[model samples]
Target: MRRLLRTTWANTVLLALVLSFVTTTAVFAKNLDVSLTELFPSDRQVKTTLVINKVLERFHYRRFQLTREFAAQTLDNYFEDLDINRLFFLERDVTRFISNAGQLHDQLQQGKVDIAFDIFRIYRMRVDSRIEYALALLDQPFNFSRDETYQFDRSKSAWPVNEQQLNDIWRKRVKNDFLTLRLAGKNDDEILKQLRKRYEGIMRRIHQFTVDDVYQTFVNAYIRTLEPHTAYMSPSTSENFDISMRLSLEGIGAVLGADNEYTVIQRTIPGGPARQSGQVRTGDSIVGVAQGLDGDMEDVVGWRLQDVVDKIRGPKGSVVRLQILPKAEGTASRRLREVTLVRKEIALEDQAAKSSIITIPTDAGAAQRIGVIEIPAFYRDFRAESEGNPDFRSTTRDVRQLVTQLKKQQVSGLVIDLRGNGGGSLTEATSLTGLFIRQGPVVQVKDAFGKIEVESDPDPDIIYDGPLAVIVDRNSASASEIFVGAIQDYGRGLIIGEPTFGKGTVQTLVDLNRYVPGDNTDLGRLRLTMAEFFRISGGSTQLKGVEPDIHFDLGIAGSDQGERSLENALPWSKISTASYTQHHSINNVQHLKARSAQRTAQESGFQMLMSRSRILSEIEAEDTVSLQEQIRRRESDQREQVLKEERHRFLRAQGIEPVDEDAESPDEEALEKQQKVIDKIQTRESAHILTDFIQMQWNTAYEQRTAK
Candidate 1:
């Protein structure tokens, strides 16, 4: 499928998801209800509010306890752990919490009561004290160890973990931070700090990071008013997420999640350090991890997942020892295994576009070669750009380069594959479709104010003016739909896959800058869906993805996995007219559709795949789990295998010899015959077979252009 990096969309799939649509020419303000100084509370209110916040937080978290006393006791115990003195007059507050816990729970659950202003008044006072304390530390140097234990330094005994050390870390972060700042064209340190502070503040407001149980309670209360996807992640939790997204390989070499103390393995990425070792298995828990083969093993019980991830990740060729706690007990004592793995890219193939060629015989004359280009996503080198490189990686440029390469081979027709592509940067998709169409409007977006704007093709030069086809399944969403819809509307390509994964809307990544103290930290992306794209034909591609001209029996239906399946997604519908010149070439669509239908029915592979898909679908829908159920599953799977075997046998039984799935792949004998056939109008079985080869469909496409 052709995946697009452009963050564009269509249809009502997304809007229907929210159960609301913006009125035409409407204007509204986002109610970000926040007091900038909430986190930086007044000193007097800090203590009172902090205690209330923590108490409420504990109640919200362990709500299953139901009883106020039990929940309060749990909260008290938790605070004692963050700091012994954290719970000053703990018993008094615990007693008070127990008395009001039921009332608070009932009121909040009913959405009729809130003690927030009163509770937060106290919380702010305590937050003020905490802020004052945290700010104090900012002036002091960071703590350090001058001893040999500090590893990086030993000759000087050890560096002091004083304010100097804190300054050093801050200074060290400057390199990456300043890189971003420079790109923003900001230089003054004071201004940068202000921006960073604003970003950090967003963490506390939208994402409440509190040890205070009561504060957590209010945050959850606030969040419940919105949809399920909106959330408030703690500061520490946010930090952990940032690390996970950036981590590569080394160490124990596994992605993990926690089910209590067990570090359960997620998927072991192929060709990654974990997969290469071949010793680890999914469902295996890493009970212990050590830096080296004989290094001291640390039992990673109840530790944060990121902390465990840290122990297991390192530079390539590093050795990490792990004790695998068997998924089943009594298998063996924790097995100690050491794996020295080199870090490699796990999603390397997914990072770039892939291509293929399909050949099909025509009814009256010869076969056609159809080139398929599958773009995964549009990606950019953000780091390179931040590093002052004007020219860096981008999807538009990448597709341009790939299309040029395919053209050199002289393909007859081309199919842009955009299935399962969830959309990315808007710039990429807009530029990408321009590679096919001459300069004109590609997508028309209508904002809430009924402000309509037509985004024109960024480039006017056509890359290849060949017979074009676009393949999109239900998974082809957002930008995928935009490009496909444009090409189809322009009569530039025939969309041949199932209806796209319709995602009609555009989302802007809202930077949490307003709440941060400094831009140096707490930066994050919030994707907010807005606007919708309408086709020139007066139809929206939102919920209703682009339908193919040649409707082949691909095992996909809208209700099954399309945008229609998504919760809070947009719906399918038509829109009003926008003037557009109808491309004259589209008049032949009916004939093209008919021609494709007859050709597909004659293909053995198509028949076999459809039958296999049906059987698999049936097997998947079963509810049985007994040994008898196993028998049925085996029978179902075997049927698919048998069908394949028989087809192979049928080919062998024919005069045609067995060959790899690549047709027109230059068998020495075929190559010699090709020259003779090319020299004269020679009628031979091999020539017909070669012309109709489905495996090397690209070759057939190439021949179509040359044969003409």
Candidate 2:
């Protein structure tokens, strides 16, 4: 229940649901006929579907079933899944499909899947016609001077009434594509070639989609209606899902899923090539992939997620180039970036807890030496532990070693930087919490059946009792939240930075083949949400993530991110607090807040970050862009320059050396490692914040000692 993409299948059906909203329902007199012959579902698919539905009914966190009300949701999910962009199916087609909304549940329960396939047939026909229109527009010269705007997000807009209206929309879409390339320095002929290839790629991919693809989409659409995290993987995607579960998989290290027509980056593995590259990010669209330094980019806009993943993965040490279309918050106009990464096996050494010592200058001549430990993840070697290996690798074990070293240096305070640390092993979280405080409950678990269990700290002795601060961000989630939440509840440390990613549920992977005996067929898997995690203080970290005691104004913080942003996510709730004694009290929280705010206002890095955040907000708020080529080009250049200048300024302020403009990295692997070093600088400012906190606490303690 962490901030994971949840197998290879969760959130795969989001766009479909978004585009399937009912704006104006119309009844059609046309008789739509469908039969099981058209579906051609395999025996495995039928059995898997039935078993998945049963699991959802019995063990899912959400208990609502395939009633008439839920059936309407299923129909909308189906229509939207088929035509997420609203470019293919006409208003009348949707109207004709509306009549079957109430009866879909009964038909599906009886193993009748003809409705989904029949609806898909109409969608295919519409796609063929639309592709022809889009292809025809590629030949015409567009008037760039016209001040016409294309609505990119048409989820709320009414569907096109006729073929003429739809053609007009496609014409604008093609022109916009041409203009984006033109601004990127492509000539007219080159633009035409690229656009034609891209459009044709879409057509080919649409036509090549197998029956399984339609079935998977429809089934996932239903699964998502139950909950955002519950998902059903197809036989082929199941293989990819299993591969994704393993940390040692040799690939680019980024999880991928379909978002409308694009393959979006879901989560970058903590020690993977993509995470180290600093070029690819969550929500970025991989539009094309190429091998080596100079290779032809394959247009992948309309390709399936499995196909995209296959192209990105290769032998270790090989380079893959990804054509990235960054996720624009509220606008459709986004610039493209190309990132190159050398594939490698994810090594545990790269993700181990790293320690550094910072000597912070305090009031007068006193100086405080603070220990900083950057924990990239809460990982534990389950196989090693299960085999009873004496030296099993885990966050708690690695951190203990680092703390021992820091203690030998006689550091006055400790800062556990959990920024980008998405949760891993829950046991590691509990054990790590044990390192700081005496034995107590670390977190609580509640199942759908209302059974509650409390996980304890699992240790009685405290190792380090000095002033501690835990730095977290929006990406800090699940097990991270459990640990951070415990620290705050026990009054053992100050929680710094943005709120944690609210993910408190527990998911178990159920193999469908297990239920159907004597079946050699691959029935895929179901990732079902069955339980929830809560803090020892009784507060649930579901939609409401753990709030920081000393909040920082980071760009991603306070934005519409985390569990609350997801649809059908569980609500926040509270239970009776666990019995635990407070470890220590800072006593001067207001003063600390005031002093930190004063310093942040004057800090050059923070100022630059705030400015860039404002620019991003403005960009997101914009509904239209100037169609004029010169205006568009100038705007793009200005935005890029501002960001570049701000980044350089921030780096200079942090006293970190910037990458040499003239010194290009020899290859992708070297560049990625270099980028990882650069990303670590951003955390330097957080270290400074922790230093300030320590100094403030030291001053207060020193004054109290003098008074005594």
Candidate 3:
């Protein structure tokens, strides 16, 4: 299971669970009236913290001294982790904590974490007070005619200076919440009932927080200050991580994370029912969940991630419905929609490499058959292989067979589509590259001590050597970057589409129990970023990912997404280029780009996609929304209409009928059809580009022969 799991999502899922458990428990446990003294760090947590500090100080890839500055930064991060929007913590509270920032380093080293608990107690008190205030506000009728604005994204805003200022903010907040539900067509009574339940749920969640949760949160707050990728998981979180790696859980295969109070969809697993549904997407917030078709929807906006996961996961073949707030709508928008999906086990076969043939018509009335292979992830059944099984399922083995089949079909060119492939096994990445070029170095790994190890393609055999192209998007990362980097460095193929996700660092899970020897206590685990990957060509795909030879506008800006956007992310660096042979040179890359650009401009589908991207970008740029009912309604309707028109235009361009706005969820056949249409837009274009490259190569060879 460890060998098979290499994607960042695994670490992300673990960290998210840790955060979710710690962040929401206090809100839910208010009714229990837990004593504040019980929330202090335990002896076990103290020992674990000391061990974690030692491990990171000695082995973490990024090295830094535990100075006052570092302590201050960690303190700030802890505050942010607890109250991301600066809603609960007042200006006085922040000022009070600032005095302890300089002493945090010394206290942590001495296994003292009383300050973490102190701040948490104040935060819980603030939450309880705010919920009561909000409940009281629900009794008064809001005047929708007033022209006002609510700044929902308060991450950058200053904390409230006093109780009055805080009250005003909450007043606007509760008003915005009421207006959102009213806009969604709910009556005043329904809106008031829902708001009261939501506020009370917040209190209930906070009351559920335990001492362990507080300890985990503080440790992670310190760890995250060192690097975004590194995290400390609790025992329960470690158990869940193991379950995910084993693929034994039955659920909608979505990796979830906490974005403030909402449980946002990080990424859907390749073989999961969520991925197959065509409704779930990264960044969508699951606000409500219901079991079966007729079950009443239970609101889960502020619920713990573990609680939400428990609800979403069920026996295979059972139905689960999700009320999603699409990410593009912004937090202020209340355009909630529900999607129904059947639970299923995420099987290995569903995520394996698959092949297809795309026929492109030529100017000479002949059709060029282009072989397309989609690799969802780089996977390997290591346990099966170690047992001496002759045919172990791996990305390399499966892709090698697929290449052979494509060759037998006499494909004019080949396209390896790696869009949304978050990456997996590193061994599989190197082995897979071997099938393309002769034996050579694929990637380089550098440890904290600066020791470099080169991973190379051991096999001297080449599978398919014809005109080749690799398609990548923002999601292609880790092992995927390793493979694509090698392909580009060797000039083995033309890289197409968006820049790859910059995630070149390597993480290893370390069991804390191992350090204690015979101790029976489950000390949880630490996902330590101990190494960094460098391309064979010298550059590291850390913050700046591999640039494609031919680019496509996929509605995403490379800078604002992926590893580059993460705080405390490792910077891009370089090393000496490795020794390797260039298989082929693409001399006409500029001409190919021009050809692709022309075709893209003429395609209606591309135009529609670009338009939709602009609309989403506009929405993402706004930090405030109008609180005036009529103004807000006008803006919302206009935005919805534009988005609807774009969708209809895209559907018409593809010769598919657009579903109505209030249409029921599409069945499997309809979803498959929609997926095919979406796939055709990109894959078909890639096939055309590959065909163009093939012709260019043929023409160049003919010219060289004539000259000779």
Number of clashing residue pairs in every model? 81, 0, 18
Q: Would you estimate the TM-scores of all the predictions?
A: 0.50, 0.89, 0.94
- Supply the global lDDT for candidate 2: 0.73
Global lDDT of each candidate:
0.46, 0.73, 0.81
lDDT of 3 at 398: 95
TM-score of candidate 1 versus the correct structure, residues matched by position: 0.50
lDDT per residue (tens digit) for residues 563-658 in model 2: 877767888998888878888775677766787778778877676667667766776555455666666766776776676677677666656555
Output the number of the lDDT-best candidate. Answer: 3
Give one digit per residue, the lDDT tens place, for model 1 in 605-692: 4554456456545533432222222332344346535544644554443434543322322243433333222211111111222233
Better of 2 and 3 by TM-score: 3
Arranged by TM-score, best first: 3, 2, 1
The worst-scoring run of ten residues by lDDT in candidate 1 lies at 17-26
Better of 2 and 3 by lDDT: 3
lDDT string for model 3 (475-574, tens) is 8898899999999999999899899889988787789999899888888999888888899999998888889989997565567788987888998999
Measured over all alpha carbons after superposition, the RMSD of each candidate to the real structure, in angstroms, is 20.1, 6.8, 3.3
